[model samples]
Target: MRPLSFQAVRSLAAGLAAAALTGGALAAPAAAAPVHAPGPVTEQGGSGQGARLHTNTELARELKRIEHASHGRVRVRSIGTSNQGRPIWYATLGTGPTRLMYVTQQHGNEPLGTESALLALRSLGLGDDRESRALRSKITLGIVVRANPDGHHHGWRYNYDPGADPEYGEPGKGYDINRYHDPAVAPDDNPATEAAVIQRQYAAFRPSIMVDYHMQGRYAFPPPDGREITTSILWPTNDDVSAGALRAAKQVGVRVHDAFTGAGAVVSQYPGGSYEGIARNAYGLRGSASLLVELSALPQERENFQIRSAAISMVDLARAAASGALAGIDPARADAIPPRGPSLPGGSAAAARGAAPAHDAAD
Candidate 1:
């Protein structure tokens, strides 16, 4: 969804942005601020190398390009080093009070969301436009596009030293890097390096909402008659998570869902966050509202016609937060997401191509 409209602030937003930039009316953004100044969308677009997935070299080069293209509006920071010594980076944008952070590709093999984040950067280059101002003037967006560069380089699910190969059962759920970090869950498997970098971002950005993105194969719930879910969303379900935080997460989760469904993605509510070890729950423990969205891996070859609905939802959700609609989302409505799904409304042209009947395991 494009969001209701910025009609209310269309007149004043751009001026406020200019004045904020010139007069320093806004407080200093976090250390990892936006790297580019809102300008022309860089020619080096999307993940540059589609479908093939990016190697470490390719990812590094692109991040640098995004930084340079920000024209100084965005800030790029090397928060920490990954297990293989890759620089884990973050880019910040916008100047609004509502802090937002997007972390993608935590599972090395799931690169779709990372590509989406890159595409989002291209859109963020709009300078002084009313809608752009509406977003930048109301929110601060931070992004960590590659949360698992090492694993991503190895083209495996886990960020293990040498990484896992799909040929061998991809052992330990691709090390299921998502399940580590919180020592309380797995002391032996905790990924202190990557986890620490994320914790640092949490402390500095202090986002009210954070989203972690991933991908899976086709799956359905409620068994026989269940809906085919191309995307599944969930709020942190850690027992100790406060109601306020849970409510906030639910609100964001639902808004993201609505945006995805509105864009015609086959979507569903995730089976609840039974695992506290996941990044969303871990961040929730830090007092920020957090959630995770699992996108169904799509055919990477066709780009133009195959707009990944999950990616569109991700971008729209950020704009929602920027425009302030996300904050008004009802927790009750979010909670209403059944264990199975309401499924995708039929006949929408926005649906992803090649959506198969729900089968196989949930990715």
Candidate 2:
């Protein structure tokens, strides 16, 4: 990548310095995903259950607003179709050397990320900020605004069509898309006709850095206190992630974590070695610095805060990558944020990290 603009470089340098002083503590990831507050291309006035969740129709309307307002700033497209034949849409801006991809609503119930995503797209397309321009110039951003429209429409997690399930539990019970990126095991045989629409985006986009967004019941990575938590992040818990790539992934994760914390959002590290078929390990193995961002529900807070936290973290990390702040990071340090959570006694380390064996998450 070309040298980052002076401002970008300085911003990166300062962040690196802060990281160094903190001994790379920023590498920790947050936890869980949640539902959204819905409306017609508008911001949430509050948090938690108080915010209106977006119905599929509402989301479609919002996407339309983005497409209409983008002008030439973003290229909107239907990457593929869901099992129910709903189109999976994306908004792409920039042609920078590095491609950054963010896929949200992977779990049909997890719509919180959509709020931040819409806000980000609007800012980039309609707003004229120097930072946004610089960041876009350095990174191509591909956003799968909604990875599972079928689920979104029905308020379910699995795609209803036979195409969404190959082998597993019943349709709605066994179609968790996050659990299907093993590459080695295509669960019941991966095929365009069977593999998920989001999987198609993963294959086609081939981003340099990928972040998958989801919301979960509030709880620490190890279910600490069984209480809810905030945004969670995870690097590759498996051996597939290269040392170098892990470092880059950590670099971005750390920056994003700091961004969230700075914004006053609750954040934590997802216990590693736990979730096997996750996008982090899946795409990381395929050569991308990937992360899984989980937002906590249950003790759900205001939706606007959650969404903006996600949006800020994403844009901040993008800028870090574009500015080369993440390119040359010390992978060792990145990897050393120290794994959290206790392993189920006798369970593998992966157990402590909350990872289940491959091919297990149809729920």
Candidate 3:
């Protein structure tokens, strides 16, 4: 790998320093993933028709709207509060053996996921569509619409914990709560209160499938062999993910990608294996098959479009999982798992070059 330019190193150091001063926490030790180069697209709004939720108060208002639209069929609760005292809300839908949990807005700037979730709830409750009714009949869905209120309110990434440094740019909000999935860091060491609440929810609820929705960084990671879009199915430690779960993850990934690619969205591949600091990984450790859906964070104005597409994709996946289509997926026919290490844009070729390691959470 080429050495980082002096200016790049200096910028990184300055960003790290700012994160330290801004109350962000240091992430646990792990090899860093190579950053992807940025894309050149401009931003655009999505097809949804509603004011976006950009603050805690707006989030609350949107939740109320969903509840009202659902006629109380959906139960919304406060899982916990952010460092800034904003409530982290969770909504429960349906009651089936298959539990699918979704967390959105782990990073404040990526607010569209939350909006999409709310919109999805509205569609489920009000739309008479075949997909909506089918999903309502079979699966139990839990949603954490906004996980980082402090950062969101400040229009930053890290919570206002007074420990994290913010100089590392977008993901460098001092501490990354996504990385605190281990039980050892639980109950207190967690910097974002929202993360702790999510941890507790996973332990208590034990959903069979989990999905974390977030916007990607500036760059796009295209799939190997020129695939259009990508979805990452993460394997947690226990190796408890059932054959059914794996099939479901791939089915959902492929279906979502197809929808986006058909709509002219840039698609990419995200290799699936062990991963850490992510909600999907943490939840997977406890026996759930999890997929982390990342939408490229380019063309700031077009984020809304990405968010809407992702939300629609999520709803479709939920319906598919509820209907038993995903559960019955055959793994053998799915796309071959990328060789271990970096296969996507910005991935580490070194990791891909070696034998695939036992699935670890921090990969």
CA deviation > 4 Å runs, candidate 3? 1-53, 128-134, 164-174, 183-185, 188-191, 218-248, 262-264, 271-275, 332-363
Put the candidates in TM-score order, highest first. 2, 1, 3
Tens-digit per-residue lDDT, 238-332, candidate 1: 89888888888888887777766655555666664455666877778777789888775443332211124444555566777776776677778
Quote each prediction's TM-score. 0.72, 0.73, 0.68
Better of 1 and 3 by lDDT: 1
lDDT of 3 by residue, 135-167 (tens): 677888888887876656654445556655522
Return the lDDT, model 3, position 11: 44
In the order shown, what is each candidate's alpha-carbon RMSD? Answer: 9.4, 9.4, 14.1
| The best candidate in terms of TM-score | 2
User: Residue 313 deviation, candidate 3, in Å?
Assistant: 1.0
lDDT of each: 0.59, 0.59, 0.54
TM-score of 3: 0.68
Off-target runs (Cα >4 Å) in candidate 1 are 1-51, 162-175, 183-190, 221-227, 300-307, 340-363
Q: Least lDDT summed over 10 consecutive residues: which range in candidate 1?
A: 32-41
Better of 2 and 3 by lDDT: 2
